[model samples]
Target: MQIVKYLKQYRIPFSGLAAGKHNFEFEIDDKFFDCYEHSLIKKGQLKADVEMQKQENMLIVNFHITGVIQLTCDVCLSEFESPLDFHERALVKFTDEDWNQDTEEVLVLSKTDYELDIAGLLYEYANVRVPYYSKCAEQGMNQSCDPEMLAKLSSEAADAEEDNTEEQIDPRWDILKNIKNN
Candidate 1:
């Protein structure tokens, strides 16, 4: 498929490499997110510095990711860019078993596998760096919510409160209140 071809660049062909440390660099941009159908990060400009240590039985990969992604403010819904920097490590082990075991920090690949596809790993690293609560003033560089939008929201709330106060009470309720007072 087209998706596979696009992601081929992220595959590291380790079959012929010397058993030692190797360094790789990748540029992650808006097009990178297009590969994922439901990615939380839609737009970003990032770079990934990867260090892979290959041993006889296993490979240890370290990811250093740095970039800025566009996020929406929770308060005013305004879009802003937030800087991201994080590091994560994954362990890949080779096995002959048909059923390979994998976890967040570890991966099991068949001994016959010649390449490691890192596109999925890179996607997870970037998404996990996103904060649970995103606010423009805090995450953005010296930025705040839209003042005009905030003012409009406040005025709408005040108008709704005023309308509630102007609603007439039922005559039946008034009689009940008078009886209680007496």
Candidate 2:
């Protein structure tokens, strides 16, 4: 697991600082995922970065990330890469005293005291950035899609759909089939 040594150095320098903005970056790799037992997200590399503005007592954070997760298709259940990208921001306030955090977006830390553990923040940012509905592209949508797989999947789906409609009104459907009789 690669820790952000740069940010840790910033914490040491925070003692010498007035208020200012800072930037941080990270390159996520397979070893990073292995640390969390997150084997499900394998094969794809990710990049994450953040900008934090420190103004007197308030901290405004902006995050940007991009990556891909190898996922199984919903229809054919075949493995495919799903691309992801994300952006978000949050406000943090330094308080003279500790206060219970009500929302995940906001953080309030004791002013007389310490620093933020951006490890968790970075992890959360990457996870939340991914879309919930990510799926493999359709037959012609993705040009390189396997032809044999697409044909089998399309035929199976069409068969199921036909069966469903047929089961819904097979008897009355026969009546409609003779529409020209009477």
Query: In terms of TM-score, how similar is model 1 to the real structure?
Result: 0.89
- Model 1 has an lDDT value of 0.91
TM-score versus the correct structure, for each prediction: 0.89, 0.63
93-168 per-residue lDDT for model 2 (tens digits)? 8777658863788877677755655555665666554445544673212524556788998899999999998888
Candidate 2: regions farther than 4 A off: 1-17, 37-43, 138-145, 152-182
The number of residue pairs in model 1 that clash at the backbone is 0
| lDDT (Cα atoms) of all candidates against the true structure | 0.91, 0.64
Query: Between which residue pairs do clashes occur in model 2?
Result: none
Poorest lDDT segment (10 consecutive residues) of candidate 1: 165-174
